[model samples]
Target chain A: MALQLTRPVLRSQPRLLAAAQFLPTLMFATVAAALVELTLLRLLSRVAIHIPDVPALRGVYSAAVQAGTVTFPVAALLAAALVTVAAMAMLPRAPILAIPALALLGAQAALLVAGESALGTAAHQWLLAVALLAVLFYSTSRRMALFVAGVGVAQAAGLAQAASANLAAEGGRALPLSVAGAGESLLLVTLLAAPVLVGPRRWSRRDVIAGGVVALIGAGMLFGNASTARTLALWTFGLGMPLPALLYAITAGAMAATLIALLRTGAIERAGALTLIVLGGFVPPNSYQAGLLLAGVMLLVLEQPRGPATTD
Target chain B: MKWSKPAVLLVGALVIAGALAGLTGVRTATSQAVTLKAVAVADKPELNPDWATWVKIPSVDVQLTNQAVTYPKGGGTVPAVSLKAVHHENTLYIRASWKDQTENVPSIDMAAFTDAVALEFPGKSAVSVPSFCMGQPGSGVNIWQWKADAQAGAGSAALAKLYPNGYADSSGFPEELTKAALYQPAFGLGNPVARTDAAVQTLVAQAFGTLSAAAAQDATGAGMWRNGEWSVVFTRPFSAADGDQAEFAAGKNTNLAVAVWDGANGDRAGQKNVSQFVTLQLSGELVKAKSEDWGALWFGAILGGVLVVLGLAALGWAGVAGTAKERA
Candidate 1:
């Protein structure tokens, strides 16, 4: 009886990892991307004001800003429309997976397009991170919940600071540190207490070493290469300093890991097929990039784990 | 006679492979964009001052912003660009003209914004267009960048010979006051006053975010700013294919994307007005253009080989399984 229970616990670990990490990372990326598009809209509007003589350009700007305002609902409708058609036409074996994914797709898309202002955008991204953490990864363990909350809250704070210049003050002192205005010096000191505030959890030697290395690298990336001082390594969005390359890399790694786990559940192929189609929308691939997709599909097929997987 | 399941499987695999190959061929053929007609000219006209005649590429909006969220909104009502191309022996010349009131040429000055125009070509075929801003990964781009500063620098050198020291204004509201911004120069190299136009540098990069600088300059251009508008002509070799740079050839349509940067708006890297992938067809030439089908061809070849191997394995398994079932 203990052996059987342990097998299931092991099986559920992968699912738990996906819920906690993969979903939140994607949400974070989506929010960042949404912010970029919104920035463009705001810039175009300002330019239009100055160049009123150019009527044709004015029309284009008007159309772009107008279309973007309803970005969430429209994008969700389009996604749902496609999903509904695809679910009907292909008659995919795993409609159950598609159904939940379809709902999340809409919800995620809607939250991603949350507009209003910097506060709203930050709030929406935070809500998304927290919601995904709770729904997907939230467990009975108090430490795990606290850890997830810490990461989510920190990311939320960073995102708000990233958007400070653009959302709160357009063309204001845009240097990342100054983007948040004059209060960063004190706030910085307070925020630094985060790692210490996590409470005393016993760490293994390996854990201690790993944590130290990560913290050092994170600090180096944050302070060493200041993007404001002409170092292009870091991008301070609005006021939040989210490292895009790091985020996307994490997202890709998480997605790949999740797909591997799903292979055991006999759901990877179906999910991968849908994912492949959706990924095309994001990165317009040339013929060579197409090869990566083919290889990925083949790998999923070959590496599928046999028998019922023990679950967590 | 009824066909065995093993035989049926082999035939089905071959049929599917053949159909895929045929469909791919059709897609490749359709991918050939409309050829841009280039007027063969002598000396690839030097900043050919006349703008009345150059056949224009669709002056698409330098559409910016809203693709991402930002505090300050994007899109500086950038003017649509126009294009004219002409080629001589082993050379392709492109003239890009756009409307810009201020002459924001490249400068070392902290606040000087240089106006620039660039032509981006796919490293390979006419059909395999990648991202609009830059060539996507796996596919590289050859970029021919022309800046207004270079043109102005070249003109400044000429102006010295024509009327040297005549327009010299030494009083820059004091160099100390403005922090060493006083533009005063003496004759010869170190003359602070005689900073001739800087040569617009040409660059070759494959993707959107690149930090690498150009080691060699290949293309040359000249720009004229008059009455709130700028016109520039850029020239590069026709068959200069080396490394990651794409080769431009006569009689073949090369998929190309254009971008114009107005420095005034802090447009660098991803910021600027851009155009969708368009075709730049050079009309006549000495050498016929080679095809850009290698990428697709290799992909198909590998796929075909895999299918053949899988088909063989399937057939063998079917045969063994069939015999076992019969025996049982």
Candidate 2:
């Protein structure tokens, strides 16, 4: 009887100790390292200290890019690992979703190994959408599941918009306004407002004060100078360029509220991961932003609260 | 170790502020080393895209992104463009080519859109490189844009060329009216798009939606479509009449960005594939110049510092206030 109890505990301990808690930390560290390399070593150095005449600094930039290239496949593999773990957890309960999830995980891993492009592009959008939908089966709450579904649909639509031009080139129909342009704007508002909508009530006085201060800083950065402010705003929100007046106001307000909610609810890590994923949507997967985004998605998948095993 | 909520918020704010400061110049690192070396030739290269010398000159293939931030944004039609550059005498010649199955030339029809491409360069007055997308305020950009319809007579004879069987009776109009400038206001006003004589337009933009015809129309180019591909060549002198245009000289390095539009995909204005800025080298040895703009750098550094100080102060205040409340 004691051996039996110890066996179950031993099995659970390996997973929890080896993969469960450590995975998110590993993904976060990888992402942090990549971002530091990209922003500090590459971009900031180029702007602040990397003089054009300095061949050594230029080499540093090249080295950073090389490092990013290597990190990309590793990041993809970790993402695949997360999906595999989630699938295995759901295998006995919901094989319908689990089997397909495993199949996508296989394809994604194969693509990564074959040096194919990352997910979220025209070629890989369908795979990514299906994988996201499959992951929704493990959502801890209906609201969270709905949110994931919305993100999947929006992401797929954005990818389809990229493919629309090729279709139109082949004598197919075209959209009047860009789905990506509108979708990004809508998503910015939605993401920034999500925490508030699903947040805990009764904000602490300290949290409110903190939120107010952040809101001021955000407003000042986004609405200060005409030239630099717009650039900063574009980067922060990752919304479509040439920011319209109405959309800009909406996003700014949403960001403020979200910041308050995040502080009040103390859901910093999850919100941070989601924010990275949203910001990554602005650029192609080939960019450093995509590397950060992949890490963010992996962190979220690993950190998600496990639901009861399905009986189906 | 257990961490307080205030400490986590403070740390998070610091990280975010630092990250944003570092990402201000993020787009600069988006592209790889794409050098369009302008080979020195003794004589002016043939204007044809199929020029023999072009075959000898190496080309740089630039990957393009169809994800535009502005309106009417849906494009990936031409995934990439190949660029080759050569200099003969004081003139610089650049050839750009991309794949396209259908040749689209704009007509007077409301639905018709022309295939177009443009090369954007920092204005001669710009102290630092501007945004790749139109440009930024204060720092402007000069664009040399070419259109298929302009090469084919700017939609004037496009109806006749596209539909040989379709006819309209123009004899009903009075002869004076037919010849009057009033009949073609845009062409009479020297609008580049309406003008039939030029295939390329010299334009300048301060930011998005700010593109306008430059005072000097010194640049010209032509486009040829064959074998399901379109190749366009733009030629301009090494120097411009004024600061509104981009000035180039041998041995000097400059940034070059390209935008391609597919008429079949209804790409126009903001809807087009764009490449990140790449280095363009003239015939002489590449010379990397030091930046002379210290004010902008100082401003950025100071702004980041201020944000860090402010964020820490606010979060620290929150922490102290929470501690006092607990003690009370």
Candidate 3:
């Protein structure tokens, strides 16, 4: 592993470097902890938190309860933003992750918010497309990522909304419009991933690990449950467990290999921390996934590498 | 400790699953079966309802939609699946049959999906079975799942038989797509059908993974689709390594559940119909399962695909940080 020492960069400004080193990681940990805490609360309250819509007061209370759901994650994002400001004040390179990390955190908060609303739901898909692009190109190829973002904005803002409006005027046919929405989202990801995979970037370890973990989780969900595994195997694909497993595995493995290649080829700088920050907010396997992501980010930012040994 | 957090996470998943399973103890659904006078083979055409002795288990109609956030839009009701189970010559044979309009087996195209069936049994030897909903995550269930395309016999050259005009040019078909070995059923290396050449595959699982492929496939079955119906059969050894799995012994009573997915219905993952725990009478006078309220179906199909997506990201991260040196 290569170390980019911040202390030298901070020789004239130690306090700034110290803040840089701690800010992102601490913010990441705080966000991770908050997500984990929310998971715990949600699990514990799975059956307990039903707000009925009846009397005006009850409806108001229910609406408040629903609105309050976004409180924690948004707060975590705000705190991270504050910490980013603190870190950026001292270290110029700080806040490298804050941009993309906050974007994904905002996306997650959108889901936490009125995710069921039409526009909110629509935006969620676009955000996911952005997140996948983060997994693929974040530090490895910012140019490509930026380009994809540009394309996504143009497609979603101008084309998709217009298509929705045109279809809505024709009598609100849902299935076709929904399909269009899904296709747009799917196309965005395919576009984001394909070029990056074929580009000059080398393999990134973060991408590989994240891809592999997601595949593993899919496999677990598929094979872990007998009913699901069987339906997909027999009725759905006509292939057995192997086909589905291979599907997820190959998708993940390809991303992993591409990421690894990018890393080995030295295509970019330390996007690993940024990647982890993004993952910490989104990819949760029981809340600890966020923890693991934060822990990875912390190890890099907090624990500076030592100098080579000197002989006596 | 390095393993503490993940371990706790795993425990939390299990506990939550167990608690959920405990909540559904009151639900029960059954699939009836009669003994077979003769042995049954996976691809054997002679194995019909009379030979297998069919017991029609009414619709497992507990269904769910794409609400899980995986597939965008698709869902339909599951027609009842006819189930048959018998043990002959050290093999336990269980067959599932259901009605489907289209045989959506070859999935090289869009909106194409094959039919599938699954059986869940307590992974333990005890009479006390866990809930049918995947045994509360880690509580463990030895599931024998049979997918249609993966089945043998009737599926022989099935693509050629079904789609004479599926392609525009004869030579246009890719050669690599022709071999079964290249399939890599589930996630294991090599092929399970190397010796048997059977298509109906039986896979085992404990919980929602990122799960690994079973080391060995001890069971097999084949699917036969004709006139808008599919009958798939499963045959496994009468006895498996006991303790944390269902016993396949003769004359033993056990509890099991059945689930079916009509692929065209956009049914996949947790989005399908399922049955509650039903009694499987292996010997003597038959004991039919008490058909309680069918409402339990909805309780089981409620899904969470987000966790699955999260688990995938974690897998990729693990790949990068595979070793301490790598992290360094």
Candidate 4:
């Protein structure tokens, strides 16, 4: 009886340990896939959008557009699956936090399977807002927690505003500015500055230099010509940001600096997650996009336990 | 127990590979959408939705949402639309259908509204597609809008014939006033709203407030309502002489967007269901215009490719250099 009991215990420990080890890697994969789906796909679409009328480049544009559109949803779906698995793996370690996150994801997946009805869309939006809150709750670092909370609030407000905007339009009256659009822009600007505000305490000399170069380049783009700013504004506008072009230019520069800081400090997963969140902002309001944004939030905030089965 | 470095890396690679393989399968399924082949028929496809040729071709169900980006945003009146297209000779006929419980026709009554649908295409000379909304500055769009009232008025142009119950007795007005065409400013100025020549209006816009009638009027359309469903057909030639109009060619890929307005839902300009741009493949052999200079476009494409490649390469090099320095 003693031998059997010990044997079972031995078996469970390794399995738990394996899951613990697997969580970070799964999160990394999730981040990578989401980045490809959101960022890379959007970039390709931008290129295609700009060159659709060029006869010589028509073939290239057509092929790229088709490939990008087809693969983006697949990448998003894959990221969702990986995130779900990662959340499940975290259950044994931090069941209290992981359960709600996992439940939210599970509910989203089930709703998606049923097709996006009006009821389903509303439910998904609320669940997404809650999921961001879960991210805020899961953060181990105080500074990161604050940032996540702010982002969560902004995202929730933005979603609510978008829904209301739809209703308000029915009155045949127009608002001076779209609150949802402004909120989304604010969220993006905050996210772009995240690395500077909430990153590692000390940065390497090389990191500082690299970040400087990125900033200079961004500044040059912003001040160089009206076209760059115009393009950025148009791109953001297409994604639903009705803000000025100058604001978008400044944010683009900040985005570059943040990425350099994160990568240099060895936050590869965070860098990828950040990219996803930023790109997710630009995509049209949809359930799958919202879920992916939440996934980015989860990956950015969820801290993996250092040891096996540490019930934090 | 400590895991070996190589073993960990191997497991990680395998997991990523498995995920990629699954995604590839999904990609394959999605790629099938790119091959939305247009049916080629010898005879001119009839404008009727129930025509034998139209039913034989495949149909795509496109989801739509409200025009939230602009004011008057209450859309989702019609959740989805079914589209079928065919090319016969030099003309392309596109049929769009959606389900509705009531048919709202245009009327002289101030409270009455007309059901309308429009197809938007990017201008031929645009460096990029304009805003999916009406359009953006710099880049323009060509719009072909068909209204239920316009269709109803196409056959019977006289106001008396359209609204028999509504009496507009010109008997009270002086004969001189009735004879003076200038008295009717809208019709005299060639306003599309006042004209009854065609059911479809060919329009151009640089942005929201810039919508106006196009110089070229090559497209025509009609709508029929039966069994609580509206089927609208848009017919246009493969090309238009005016630069403001979108040109379609055989065996070329173009982008298309759709919008629908339900009169009963108080849907009108900017308050209608809309769709994102979808790739439209016209079936045939692409005959390049040899007279135009292709060198400039080729150079621009090459330059863009080079810039992108360099940017990516720099990022990769920086990453590698950083890792090497850390090891050192």
Candidate 5:
């Protein structure tokens, strides 16, 4: 009876399957696009010796060319193509996944524009945004979406709380500024990864690896300069481990509890535990901010209980 | 398990390679040396004594008691004549000591404060002597010694003619005699008229009297006088032009030579040209001088430590990534 129920459910949820199949391909494409953009930007800088400045318009034009035209479009097209191929292969009739997928793509575009300004001239912001969007598309599901939205709300609330706490310190502004900056990046990654995490399918082995690699590379690029590396190393040594270690520990405990609970009753008690663990990690201001964000997203997606019918 | 061993070896090799690269950039030690010398000449009339016994010079002076005269070292066993002249070409040699550990002592300007020999020639008229050439004999010139004495209220009535500025009073006859005849004058004796031929006889007599009184005052001088063999050497005056001067040279000629013993202890001997009345040689070595720029090394070490931490972090990230991949 369980087998019979699973087969029909698997056939019905084609969008989730397609997203899972496309995750790795999308990540590889985004990385390729970023490399190409980086190379082109370097070449253009060498060749365009006497380019005229256009006041306020120059920054906008430069960013659009670098982030939108070069990095974003390439990453998006590659992701879209992979998703389309996977969808066709899995179940061509289900078009509902396209709605969330397209919405994920739009969020990627917005992220690219914002990131182009924030990450400075060195990074391929648009490519990173697209890669994030692909991760979200792969994970999309109602529960995962609500969890991602909740985490984003938590980060926003944290930023507001940091601002309010500024009055307690001499240079009160720094606490709020750091919170906003960190929270914004976390939000972007969460938003981009939401659709995939909340999707009806489980993550494949390849999907997880690709997701982890993309996240690591993105974090490294953002914080890998000499000054940033030194700051991170110093803080890690002086103040114990990175802030995300606590989150990992909590997440591990939750997972252990969830596993025990699942073995006995197959209930979704794990999701709540994992959520608490992720929240614990996200609370600290330390070098593990990126790790916490990625971990939180992963825990939210993986801990959700699947119905017996959807097990296939 | 087969793959694990090779992976571990590769990681070990990387760590070793990084450490080797860091060690290779370490800095090493390095050094350079410097030298100086001076000479004297005598006049025809002064040739009887070979002009070794200088009668007049503006910068420095030397007077020997009837018993203090001595033959040149390593020359002969004969006692030098106090009233007569003895000449063996006199030379003073000096070696400034610098150890390998010593740093930041540049070859340039090392001669400025090392050692110097000056010549003083007293005059009947104190006003005739230039300010650079007056001081106690054997003692170096104290360019402002007279001024210092005045400030101390130890002014002399006789020094009124010496310090026209009223900065100091006259020096007492016996004290002034010993100072003028035996040491380099604080003020330079640039003029021939300043060290009058007439004053030379009286100055020598006064120096003799002071020595006799000091001998009576202390039994040590009398004992040394009775036991020690003494001698004197006089050189001919080369010319008046050479009398009030200074020069630097190395090796053995008439220039004054200094030999530093046991790193810090030193002995000075000067040769003067009484004909022109100028300083021939002045040299010596001083110890315990300070080193330069001990700060920069510490700064570089701090910067290097920071670079090391970054390199380690890069390695750490690679390690974590490898583990994650293995688990996946």
Candidate 6:
């Protein structure tokens, strides 16, 4: 009986520790991304000479700098992803792993160069696809899960800060409330599902309770703000949010959840979940384009013969 | 090795394509040209020497002349004399001629007979007239003048009104020549003097001198002469308007000619005379001629070429990058 109790406690301890470690990485990634973005903006101002008005150029430069600053969390995840991939590649000694790893790195580079322009709906979908592929090719389930959870948390924090900053700059009450509502909804959903996806298969009472709390808080925040709540209700009623914002929100949520899950479960399940979530967001309103991609990934995952399972 | 060959070929092709695109952009940018031209009108006396020529600009082919014709106190005014053949670029000049009929005309009273000239440009609706006259060779000194409204009945009254001392219709007066001298002490024309033909000539010479001084002060002032003859040389090449085309007119007949030259280079381009003469009822009127070509294409081409080069460079870079990626 003591052994059983100790085993469960020990299993949960690593997840908690992993979650803690991932948080700082998320922060670092956020700062790095922001710095890179700011640098790009400065460079663009110096080089792009077509701008006629000095004030307009200054405004654009400032906006670029702000966007760069907001991109830190995403940058952190990218860095973490790279490091994890590198570690995995070293452990497996597979030359092919380098290809996918390099591709991820390339995608991150592209995202950095493109700035906010790259965060459009199409780009988010592409990133989602890449993440899914990475998850599949990952040597260890733990690393994949950790990647997802780390990305999710970082995205949540970064987007929340961005939305807040945007609201403050706009100097209006309504926009802030609406943005906060959306961000909270995203945070709650991501944090709630993350533990389930990344934690051990047999969830303990604490994990279940944590998930419930997160869900409750997230759902409450989403519903509390009348405007955002109305928007979501509209979406629920078969209406849809604007494509770009919706894609961004969904991608951010998936990344947060995956990162959280990775922290908890030490498995790659969060990666697949993130992929599904992003794919769902990418599907056009009243159309099923993304469904095909999702189906392919699912098929691939299912085609892999089941390996023997061991009790945790 | 096989892929490398294909990649190298692709890169080469891209670079070539980029270069071509850049050249094309450059060609389009430098395609348009713009031009501007300036012209000058000669003094009226050069067109008709009887009139005192106030200003002359040879570079633009302008000549102006002014003269007073006297009528011997007799029956039926002498038939208006058609003086000289005024060139198209030149205008006939005229001045108000006064008579001192009073034997006891005081030196101060002689101020009423102030001699003044009126110059009219063909295209301009208004005339230009000088008001007060100072002593000959005097800088900024007023020599002789008449009270306001002294010469109101003259044909160029509107032109005369532009002068400071000339009669202004708004001021209630008989609009006739007044014995009171309109000399301003500020301009050094305060002392009254006896009215005689010599006085008139002195006044005329002084007026010409003042006008010449004024023109010298102005950036656009054409040079003038004390005698009725004056010429202007342009610093740059210029073209004249058709009405400003150098011409000679006497009574009903007029001859037109094109004047071309560069004052700076001391090159007097050949003058071309027109075949047809335009006859008008009026005498001593101003005419102008305008030139056709002005050079501005060089600047346009230079600017366009620069833009094209920049655009081409960008396209080249893109192509090079694309080619490199393909090869890789």
**Rank list by lDDT:** 4, 2, 3, 1, 6, 5
lDDT, residue A210, candidate 2: 57
lDDT scores of the candidates, listed in order: 0.40, 0.57, 0.42, 0.59, 0.28, 0.28
TM-score of chain B taken alone, candidate 6: 0.17
Model 2's CAPRI class? incorrect
lDDT of 1 at B140: 63
Backbone clash count for every predicted candidate, in the order shown: 49, 0, 58, 0, 88, 75
DockQ of each: 0.02, 0.03, 0.02, 0.03, 0.01, 0.01
Relative to the true structure, candidate 5 reaches a TM of 0.20
**iRMS of candidate 1, one decimal?**
24.8
For model 3, residues B103-183, the per-residue Cα lDDT tens digits are 766543356655677777776543334535455334566777666655533343665665666664456436676443455
Docking class of 5: incorrect
TM-score of each: 0.36, 0.46, 0.34, 0.50, 0.20, 0.23
Cα TM-score of candidate 4: 0.50
Provide interface RMSD per model, one decimal: 24.8, 20.3, 20.6, 20.3, 30.7, 31.0
Ranking by TM-score: 4, 2, 1, 3, 6, 5
Which segments of candidate 5 are over 4 A away from where they belong? Answer: A1-24, A27-100, A104-227, A230-312, B1-328
lDDT of 1 by residue, B98-204 (tens): 77767776555556667877777776543344444455455567777777665666454544644556677676465455434343323233332233443445555
Q: What is the overall TM-score of model 2 with all chains considered together?
A: 0.46
Candidate 3 lDDT over A73-174, as tens digits, reads: 332333334334333442333223223334544544543442222233333333333333222211223343343344333233323332222222122221
Which predicted model would earn the best lDDT? 4
Better of 3 and 6 by lDDT: 3
Please tell me which predicted candidate would have the highest TM-score against the true structure.
Answer: 4
Task: Compute the lDDT of residue A124 as modeled in candidate 1.
Answer: 34
Model 5 / residue B274 / CA error / Å: 76
Flag the better candidate by TM-score, 4 or 6: 4
TM-score of chain B of 5: 0.15
